[model samples]
Target: MNAIPPAVQPPVNDEIDLAALFHSLWEQKLLIALVTLLVGLLAAAYAFLATPEYQVQSMLRPAAIKDLDALNRTGVYELTPEQAMQRVGASLESYDSRLAYFRANPGLFEALRQPNRSLEQTFESFNREAFKMLQPDPKKIDSLSAYVGIQLTYPADVNGVTLVNGLVEHAIQAEREKIAADLQTVIQNRLNQLELKMAAARANYEASKDARIAELLEADSLKRAQLQDELKALRQQLKDRRDNRITQLDEAIRIAKALGIGKPTTPSALGEGERVAQGSVIRTEVNNQQIPLYFMGSEALEAERNALLQRRSDDFTEPRIAEIAKELQLLAHNRQVEVLNQRENEDLFLKDLAIWREEATRLRNLSVDVTELKLVSVDQVAVDPLRPVKPKKALILALGVVLGGMLGLFIALLRNGLRRGASRHHSDQSSLSS
Candidate 1:
């Protein structure tokens, strides 16, 4: 009997019963249909009631060469088309610039106001996500040109078109103003430098002029002193010679008076001629040797001495004295130094005066106007969109139906399993009671 009990085998149920599962699902088909209908209604309500969003886009490209020519011609600054475009792009991306624009134009963003949020918070959120800058992918080889685009996604009620276009214009204007201001600053700095240079030149010229005046005055003083000393010496020498001549004449006059000679007489006049041969008359010796003072006659010497004593100035007696007087007169006042000292505007005499004045004048008069200058070429302006991009009704409704059907099928299978388990439990109780 124990050997026979060992031969009993356990049940094997690896395969699923497809038929029973299908029958149970079919029995709960009404419940599945009701759940699917309820879910479908909710999905339809959401698809129809949701607010629609619109996308407005604008395309931008680099400015043309001619558009930036005016700014580049200043010589103080240079900007290319690409650089201008980059500046415009940077302005567009600046949050401060956007806020300024938004504050300046209030009516444009009136529709974006929310009751639960302040204006600043709303604007911050809008600035963060409402605007998008689209550029070509760097990894893509098909990109032919460097193009930028601005896209705005907003509610249908908002003026997306006006907002995008106005933003672009504001960015361009901001960039233009920046360029003009930078150029003006450069020109002003150059003018300041030139002014400083001119001032230095004037100061240097005045200093040099003053130094020249001092030098000329010192030279004139020294020359005048030297001339006065030379004149005094010459006059003294002339006086001494006159006195010596007078002394010699007195001595000669004493000798002549003692001999009783009253007129200029040679040796022959004293009877020497009678002793010489009749045909050989002695001639008066004439050479560089001065004749004796007594031979000049006392009357002639007395006359010359009286004339020398009566003369008021000895300058006329010597040629060198006259020359010295004339030189002293010339050194009395330096005409060049006087002219330099009396000058009111010394800058005019600077060697580089003309060059500095010309350059400074040009800089002061330099003007740059960029009011009409175009910094960017708007390839496409935003237009009112004809359709919305959000609220995909068809796709949402399809997903809702599919999900509802799956949930309903799962509920029906669980209910059928519970009913079968209840029936098995009742049968087991009845068997135990019997």
Candidate 2:
């Protein structure tokens, strides 16, 4: 019973004074009201005046430079993801190559690398301003990122939309022009090489024209004169031999007619006429001698004597063999020279034409490849942007209001504790004086 009375009489030291808290809040009512009102006004103003900019985001799947012919050949309709990635990498090479000031011009690479004072100054100025704005904004331009499309937060206003659209169009045009210009450069280089070759040929022609012409004409004239002389000699020998053969033939024919044994009749037709008008007299003589020898040796003696006149004369009587042999030798020499000249002319003409055709083909193939790249483009349309299904305003505001009220209540309690301690100190002094 004593412990219970003492427990009832003992004062609690740690108990929070709710009345003091209420009094402090009542005293600081204006300040609390002001703070609450200010917070509410700020929140409302932010909710109303702050323009919510919608970031229009749509995905872009990279469209590879596909060959319709590949489908026709393989019958496969689509590329695997790996194959698509490979194509994306290849296309990225253009971007990387042009990444140095957008493929400004020839010698641009060297110029960019070189540390010129003016260029360094320009770069410094650009980087200082660019560091804040540039911030790797892929969506600001039609940048390729793993074949994905992303647009950064931008105002849905007309100027913002126009800026994005213009950048995209500019990037596309730049890519196309870069491809075309590269083609033109390659073509121009080949053309220049061809022009150089042509110039060299023309120069060579000019330098050696007189000498070449003189050499060709002189060689041809000398060959023609020599061949003509040999042909004339051959003709003379041919004529002399022909005349001797004709004389021998005539003698044989006359003797054959006298002897009545020009040719024996064939077994198929016993009554057919003898064939003797155009045959070599020597052949006819040999046949007649052989035939006569079988019958009687003395009968072929006249035929042998008649055929001897057709023999190529080695003596001074006609000199027909000697003349024909010399003529044949001269004709052979002239033909060799003529063949050489003809072969040389044909080889020279063919070689130059082949070189010209090869050069033309190289230039044509390069131009074709360039043309193919220019035709690839963005084949997509923009639809309305999708709404973000996050951060509902009413819920966030309610949460913020609750959190603010709790914080205000804690601060009020802290003030109340300090005031209660001051009150206790005043009471202790009053008790000591009594």
Candidate 3:
């Protein structure tokens, strides 16, 4: 009998067996398509059936003003730009503050608790998502000048835009009040400091006035004493000069008599005798009326005494000295006037300082009851948004198509490998039996 040749195993395909693989896949194309279609349909249905959520968005720009300008506008606080922004940020971040705000305006949060009848459930839902609607953007938190973005996600049924707007306004008002309160505290502290300074200034002004008065009094007394001493010295000097002149006149008259100068009946001789007799009187007439006599020592003595009398005549008399005393009194009066002027000037300065202090105190104590304090400007307020933001149908459908196609291809490849393995096993068994 002819030896049956051992069943020869097929050679391993060096490259992919494209023809056979294509034929196998084509035979199972119905199964693959059915599986892919079922998966795609299921995914599409799920996507369309899911509830859609809408986004309520807004942006708040913190509009800052100068501190003095803010004070001018509000008449209550010296609020800085940075502090204003910080106050808004604090309101946005504070959960308790927001809760309190919502509680105050029940209308704001009441409508948001729809579909849930239980109070606890409503609160849980509000705390979970609704309360977070007015939070500041994390990216722009560090940069105070940048606009703060606000986003709220809610079901399509809710009026998210109107709700967000209300919340934004509420938050802004809360922050403004907070800022005003803080500034009031600051002003109070500053007022306290000003009160102390004003007290010290008043004390200093009082002391200065007292010191000036004392100085003026002392100066007036000293000046009066000096004037008295000057008057006494001038009077004594005039008296001594008067006595010396009289003694010289007496000697001249005796010399004339000793020289046998008899009184002549001429006008020139009579004038000389009269001049000799005039020196003995308290007051002398114009000496120009007298004539000179040339006899023994009488002529020389009369000339010397006349020269002494003329020199001494220019000396201050009682009336002239009294005029000088009046002038000194006038000078003292002028000094006192100057001191009074200085005091007046000091008083004026104190008056102006007091006025300034009073004005500052008025500003410090000024009450500001702001019904509205606008810290932030809404760059873009949320409008009634119609379109839903979540549950993207197109994306879901595309993903479903790709995943279903991959799964169908995997099943097709698996079936082909199983068929090949079974065929190889059956052929080997037939070869063994033969």
Candidate 4:
């Protein structure tokens, strides 16, 4: 056999074919080097140019009026604390309802960026693009948000900082309006409920008032009748007393008649007994004018006679009827006053009912407003502005060094690839020398 070439042995499992790998790599090495350098330089440039972002944080507490004391007890109110808390929470939840109102107004954001945006609109194009450029995604805004969150967020750009700040401010405004409206609505609802209760109460009072008035009217009639009856009895008693006084006067008149004071005293000149008659007549006249009238052995008869004559008066017009008339006048006046007072009270009750009705109406309006205000609730506060965080200059510098070394290695790899044929010849020489 011709001097056979020594058997060419395949490499073992533990060994790698470096020559084959190096050959394959050598083919693409130039393009790979260029791409690697480009990537490294691009990374460095990104570090230098990346904009930085600053954050503004805020926390808010939900506020609302609550019946805290009563709500704390379950057995007393037949409701759980959770339920009562929920009610209070509902009142506060309305703050989120007015978010849209703030979103439309950009001026609010401008103010927020005040120190930053002195005079620049900060963009080459429309405000929308500028805002986007200055701000980050909204979803990432909040760092710590649950009950309260960031209401607005903004990005920093040499040109568009104002726009981003404006957006954030609008967001906050929207939230605030929403909160106020919500509370107002809840209050309104409560007011309406109170009004309804008050209205019902007023209606009942009015009904009761009517019944009371009727009762009073009947009582007034009874009182008037009683007064009239009393007057009648007094008048009768007065008449009887007057009748007794008149009867005594009649008796005195009879006594005076018997005495014959007004008859002529001269005797007739016809007979012997005529002088005796004249004498008798003179005696009668004496008795009537100045006789000592004794009455039934009573020692005070003379005093009584004097008193009877002295007590008579010409002004004694029917005393019974006069007294009755005076009493009736007083009763009629009292009845009139009671009637006036009752009417005034009824009027006042009606006025109170009207006021309650008005209050109820206002309450209703407020409840509706509360619904609209719910959008601004604390949970809805903006957590993030639309801006990117600032780049770390130190980190970028470190990365630049690393990438530069990798780039130099890639350049060396390409050079090795291009000289692969020369190296292979040199390898043969090494074999001969060996």
Candidate 5:
């Protein structure tokens, strides 16, 4: 097919030659060593010159039930150990609390000061990184109890142990004060409420007493009026009886004078024979008629009328009149109303007085010293660390050497590749020129 171009063949160099690559790398060993040495020295300088940081940690656990018993006993508030621990954790995590502690105790963080930064800036930096709250991982199955920790990473020169411990104590003290204040507020509010109730109760009692006084006065007025009316009726009845008696006496006296009889005489006082005769006659004439009042004789009737007319009062004439007079005299005063008005301790008569006084006393006497309260338990206090935690010199040195060797190797390979490409290009150009 035009001599078929004899099946032109392509270059076959798919496999890399290990020996040639080794030789090329060996040729550039001095440059590789120089690069590696420079990187290693830099790593060493950084490792040695960097300041060391120390870590101090404190562990907190829930307080015992007995430790929180005092606060729980005050029925106004209740606090559990876990809640206390949570409060302490929140305080520990507060930036303001940390800043306050730092400002109040400047000497504690003096070593962290720097010439290029203000005290506030330095504290900000320290607050950002130095403090850490450590908690157990929720995913871990081995975590049985709730625990909280405060870890402080500070420079070697700073007293991390004192700083961490002081921070923990300060948080606890702050929580205590807060709890105390809350308790005081609760007790005060209760006292105020009790006072209001007591005042209301007293007012109601006074109102009731006044109402009772009014009721008694009204009843007394009614009773006195009734008694006075009854007394007046009794006196009129007595006068009417006396006046009628006088009229009957005058009629009897006129009958006695007309018949010429002066003294009281019974038919029986006459001779027996004459009395029998008169009785038979009267029996035949009078069936059931009573003897005439004139038979009582005018003298006796006149004497009775005179006695009734001369009487000063009708109180003795009827027993009920005397009783009515006594009752009227008693009603005039209303002893019950007088007693109620004169009562000095009206509250003592109130139904809930004892209960109100007892509650008020209990609230007023409710005093708790938060300083004595054990809000949390420090399972582990921060201790002075024996060694620094930062600037892991050994690991840094090892990494530096490894990275340096790898970078050096990469540079060597790049240079060798460039050289080989340049040589191949030159050969191809020479061939084209020939």
Candidate 6:
């Protein structure tokens, strides 16, 4: 096999060729110097001629106007710092809001726009500048704390400090008004509902009282009628018993006299010996002692004893009926107590409703009071600053020097590459001719 020709390779150095690089740069020093000088001059001119911007900074804390109670019930509390920042950031970011802001203060962006500009041109020019000046710092926003920071840059003619304060005021007022209006509507509706409920409760209580009174009256009338009938029967039976007893005593005395067993003149003598033996009204013991006890006629005595036994038997059902009636009345009494308790519960509910109404009214009033509230308090106010915040001359010039040096180095390397290619071409041609 024929030996393969060696591959042509560019020279490689493990160590950097410092001397050759310096020589090459020296040879093309004029071009490098000219290019570096041009870039530096341009940077210097920009640093001096550009309009300086001044920044107005202010720190704000959004005060909590309402307490925890408001948060739980109506959620009509004051704006927080996070919310304030969001509103401000949104307003600045939005095209329409920014446009409106620019319109309100016509002179704010007048310097940026040329004369006789179209509406679109004016808006575009305004937005270009507004975005640069009004943008919140990414570093600051990322590490947000309890306080919101506002920084706006403007030209010397515009008052950036006044613009920041005004923006904050407007945002706070708008948010407060929105929340307050919503809370008021909710409060009114709740109050109306509470009033209706209270009215119903009162009417129910009255109806319940009237019905209970009617029920008690009817029960009392029924009980009174039953007791009156019982009393009348007892009185009539007692009178008949008294009259029959008297008639029985007279008949016994007449019978004794007619039978001649007890003579009117000799009753005492007959009663002692013969009265008991004959079963008369007066009786005598075995010792001839007369007793005052009297006996009815046999038929009457038997009939009356039978009637008494019947009366005792009748008393059994009357007592049991009365007992049952008493129990029924007790049940009615218990029901009346339950009704009273129910009315009491309704009264409690009404009282609670009244309290709820009062609370709603209080919240509504608070909401009204805070309708146009200034929730943000300026902890640090901005003033018209005398010094310019931008166009840092020292930093710009330093960066220009570094960039210019780097460009000069690139140009030197390019010149060195061209010189190396010419030398290599000459050597190749000489070798071919030999």
Top-lDDT candidate index: 5
Q: In model 5, where do residues sit more than 4 Å from their true spots? A: 1-15, 114-119, 227-323, 355-369
Worst 10 residues of 1 by lDDT: 3-12
Cand. 5 Cα-lDDT: 0.84
lDDT of 3 by residue, 1-434 (tens): 99967777666554658899999999989878888888889889988888788887877775656323645564545555545555665666566765665566666556566673664556456666754434446766675555565677877666677777776777778766666777777677767777777777878877876787677777777777777777777877777877776685666568576755544233444446545554555543454555434242455556666766666443455676877678677756656546555664453567457675776767666766543555666778888777777788888888888888888888999999999889878977886676
lDDT of 6 by residue, 8-101 (tens): 6555444647898798788878878887787788788888878888877766655554532343345544445456556654554556665666
lDDT, candidates in the order shown: 0.82, 0.47, 0.68, 0.47, 0.84, 0.62
lDDT of 4 by residue, 1-434 (tens): 68957655443353446886567666756666676667667777887777565444433333332323322221112323333233333432333322232345445444334554442332212232322211134578664422333222334533233333344344445444544555455566667677677767768877876687677667767877876787667656656665675566456445545643232222222113334343434332223344333222122433454554565532245565566567667655556446645675453655466666666665444322322322223323334445454565667666765776577556666666566657766866776565
Of the candidates numbered 2 and 6, which has the greater lDDT value?
A: 6
Q: In order, what is each prediction's RMSD in angstroms?
A: 5.2, 16.5, 10.0, 16.4, 5.1, 9.8
lDDT by residue (tens digit), candidate 1, 126-149: 999888998889899797777777
- What is the alpha-carbon lDDT for the whole of candidate 3? 0.68
Worst 10 residues of 5 by lDDT: 269-278
Off by over 4 Å in 3: 1-9, 62-86, 102-145, 200-356, 364-369
Positional deviation of 172 in candidate 5, in angstroms?
Answer: 1.7
Best by TM-score: 5
What residue pairs clash in candidate 3, if any at all? none
* Predicted candidate 5 versus true structure: per-residue lDDT over 110-196, tens digit per residue: 988899999889999988888889999988979888999999998877888888999999999999999999999998898898889
lDDT tens readout by residue for model 2, 3-24 = 5322223253876567755778
lDDT, model 2, position 154: 37
Query: Candidate 6: which pairs clash?
Result: none
